[model samples]
Target: MKKLYSNTLMQLIIALCTFSFVACQEYSIDSQPEGPLNIQIDAQDSYTALATSPSNVVFNISSNTPWTIESDAQWCVPTPSMSASSSLVSEIVVTMENNTGKQSRTAKLTIKAEGISNTKVVTITQASKEDLVVIPYDELVATEGEDITFTIASNKPWEIIPSTAFISNIDKKSGTGNEDAFEETITIKVPANAGARREGTITVKTEFMTYTFTITQNGVVIEQEEDPESTTISVGGTSTGGTVKIRANKEWKVEVPKEYQSWLKAEALSDTELKITTTVNNQLSTRVGHIILKTKEVVDGFEGITFDINQSPAFWFNGSSENRVIDEATGDVKIMAVAGNNVIANYAIKKGHLTFELADINLNGESCLHFNLWPNAGNANIKLWLRSNSDCDFRCAGGFGWGQKMFSLTTEELNAIRTIEFFVEDDPDNIGKLRVRLSINGEEIGNLVNQTNIYETDPSNNPGQVINLQFEGGLNYTEGDYYTVKSITYEPAE
Candidate 1:
């Protein structure tokens, strides 16, 4: 019985040992030397890019199981095109096509490890690319001695070459850059052109393309002028007129007309030059005068030189403390008036046409131009007043008071430089009544009969005789009030 019991114990120990060896083999198989399936890559990837250039990014991955890289974006492509990775440490390259789009782009890339929970995502971003641009001028057609500029832009280094020396003065020649493009400016200066049209070209070269800029310049122009040989000479002062130099080979003599002898004088400076001097005309009318210059020794095919001279009309002033004549700083003629001042004229405007040009008629206060008329015989004296209102239309005194007629002229029309014409006629039917016609700037308004009847005569006697002309600045005028009369002329009406 003891031998049988010992044998049973040995059997139990053998069974326990066999079970332990099986358990060890299974543990060894489960704990094999393969690491977790994971991909090691940057969290975000970015690339600065230029137009027409490719961009790339690479990711390193280590995994026990197979791994693959994928992106749904069309512009993003994965390298190693076959399939997943076969090696433990493999590279997944992502390539972006040459950027043709004008804006930046973004994409997401996913890395998947098969049979493992290791998934990695990479956010990819790229900057927008700028195209090669030339600003302002591409082709220049300019005149001689003109300056032309060309602006160049590119992602890479650039160079500019001029075709000829005709274009010079280059401000800048080359530029250097990387992802972002830089601008370079070059200026072309053209020389003075003598005769014909000139042409040239500038070649701008960059990494991607080449630009050819062209230039053409016009020739010079020559012209000749014809006239009365000399410009009309205007004399301002009373004592001395300006001097004129003539290019002549011989001696010359100047002859002054008879009527102008009192004011005009000429002296020979040298054989070919003459200096003309004059005194103040003091007359009311501008002088239409000429001086003849003849070569003492006659030359072939040469008549003498004749110069036309114009002496400005003498300044008119009533000499009253209230009103005076003022020569403007700009050399314009003006009349200044205060209250109760009168500028009277010697010659009257009778039954004829009277024309006057006004530079400006701005009135700070109420005033009018006055005309006094006297008939031939047995007629009453006539008084006519001319005035303007805020609307720039003409107003005059009729039979009664201040506001009689408004000429219907807008303010703009009245302010502009204008000509005023007035005509007076003798009345045959009514002995005392006179007819008046008025026009402004060549447009005639209607006629007025018996306007004021200021001057009246016996039917048989001659009428429409003007006694005198005068200006009265009424009670409203101040110290600074002024007006300008450009010109005045009178003639018999047709």
Candidate 2:
């Protein structure tokens, strides 16, 4: 019984000790925690305001420890009760004084916690309202001869003065004595820009500041004339021709058409004067041709000149120094004229074979002598163009017209005074068709057939219809280039 009592008491004691050990272990586990103190702020890092307006900052904080809010900026003030109690939520308020200065400013607020060594910052920005600014900003652009307006905004009275004489028409030069308000519309005008691009500035003077507004104006361009002046001349029938004068402001050149090249030429006496000479028309009636003169440089009122020439019968052309003669035996023609004055031929057509020789063949860029036979009405035409130092060709003007023998007359042949001949005869196979045969220095070329019309019985090739014989020097008209017509003859073809 003693052993049983002792064993039971010992078991009770062991149970009490196990209970105490378990309680001690539970107490030790409850004494320590895993989570740390958490702090949070609900507020933006920055704030903005106008210079004349005051601003406020508010912060909502959730913290597990005591915290205090303060401001380092002199312009920033915080409430006296700015601390957050431990384990509680609090709202902090800070005030920013009105920014009346002339520039932008910034302020900062700091939030500090008892347990946390770290801090949070909030920034406040303010703008100044004491500036003078113009609408549409600091620059203004306008075209030549344009008008513009501007408005000034300032807190004090201001004056606007233009920096350039080109700017004019100021409606108002000074402000209306109002403060902190935009001024009335100030109008200004720009004159015609006959010069280059221009830029200037207008100074806006205020009590405390100055504003500059730039003005940029476009430039103007002078226009060129399109049509040139013109004149006319009439030639007589005698073998001797007359002279006509051309006037200009500068060095000028003449372009003669091919049809009149048989008897007409031009001479540039001075920079301003051009003398034209014609060969007395040996044919029975009147003929016509053209001359175009152009200046090398642009002149204010002078661009170009056109001449209308009318030549009379051979006997009527007497009294002029230029002369030509036809040999009755072999039907050859000889012509003479001043060097550059009259180098082309002008004649009325007769029923005969025609022969001519090239005294010289000198050409520059795009320069040539033109030859064509057609009624002045400008139809059923044929063309033969001779380019100096280059090639020659023959082609009918209208469609169905034939072209042949490109470069048939070489420079050597032309410079050697080669004779070019043409004959019109009735086509035996085709009735009403005239066959025109061409040759250079006696060498036969193309034999073309003309089916359009026959020569009229009237003294003129076509009565009431003017025929043009042109010999030009330039690509368009005539430049300072010429080809000499050494001699020309016509013989009645049997």
Candidate 3:
């Protein structure tokens, strides 16, 4: 019976033990914690009246925070604060003051719900004021040989005027507080015998302004010439060519146009093209435009020589002796002259003519001669013949019709020496012709065409043009030195 009671009790004990173990395991488990309520605050940027912004100052907080800052403000002043929806909070302000003395302050902000706090330091500095300064403080200038004074019988209190001059000082004073400003005169007086221009200075300073005064006198030395002004004659445009007038008290230099440059090939105009004038004074000065045409080839020259229509050399003869004579060097080359008879330099002979005894010639494949004819006009026939020192003779002797005139002629042949005689059978008009020649060589095997030069019909080659002497030839030799003036003679060829 005892064993049976023990067994029943053991079973009851086993059941009670199992129920207790299950209850312990169930009670030990806990509920999941709410994910952190909100992020905590960390630190903030320092505040400044001089905060160069558009640049952000970041405050690192436990992430997942919705943060925002107050952005409304005036120049360098903070009126609003920064806030966050998270557990932590940060308050800050930007403030400005009198712009002088400066210091820093910090705010200790505690974050609720989160065991965190934030701090923002603010530096306060003095502010700039609008009521200050003296304009362009370079010293004032006073002319010499004169008396200058600064009258300051009235001015602000606590104002001190610094001086770099002898007479700059406190003369009288008035006014008080901010109603303060001064009025005083600094006098600069030149001695009766003051030398030339003199100088001095006055320095002044006040709470609101600072300045320096400059003084001077005339110089002692005398310079009595009026400076020359750069005068210009501007052509309105390429619009029209007309008169351009210039005005000046003194002399001047002006540039001229290209059209006038041809006629007025001059240098250093007394003035320039049209003229420089004074309307008020009616003064006409030698300093006005005086056009002068200068030769372009000043360094070289008008390369070729000039002659009269008649082509006479008499215009070139100027001496103190016989009016007419002969040159021993060029074989009786006539030297007769009566003021203006002229002749061309190089002349060429026509179809039939011969030149002889030409001197000073370099034998340039051609021949030339110079002579003068009687001024009166007339007509006649001239005869020509050829000769050679080498006995190489070729005669194309013929009579050439001509007018009473002196002129140069060119013929073909260096050794083609030609002698021409104008047949003055009856120079009823008392007229004559001067002759010159251009010559070139020839051969029996080759019939070379002789090149010749022609003249213009009218005598209008002056004001606008010149005689264009066209040269022609089979060989076309560039002009050399053979052409020379030898002599002149007359023969009648009816």
Who wins the lDDT comparison?
A: 2
TM-scores for the candidates: 0.32, 0.29, 0.22
lDDT of 1 by residue, 64-121 (tens): 4566677867888877532354433456677787666545677777777667675676
Cα lDDT tens digits for candidate 2, 4-91: 9999999999997786567436433211112576567777998886665566667677666777777767877767445534655566
**Candidate lDDT values, in order:** 0.57, 0.58, 0.30
Model 1 segments beyond 4 Å from truth? 1-289, 293-316, 320-332, 340-343, 369-414, 426-434, 443-446, 450-474
Candidate order (TM-score): 1, 2, 3
RMSD of each: 19.6, 20.1, 22.5
Ten-residue region with minimum lDDT total, candidate 3: 278-287
Clashes of each: 2, 39, 62
The predicted structure with the larger TM-score, 2 or 3, is 2
Worst 10 residues of 2 by lDDT: 220-229
Report the Cα lDDT for residue 476, model 3. 27
Rate residue 132 of model 3 by lDDT: 22
Comparing 1 with 2 on TM-score, the higher-scoring candidate is 1
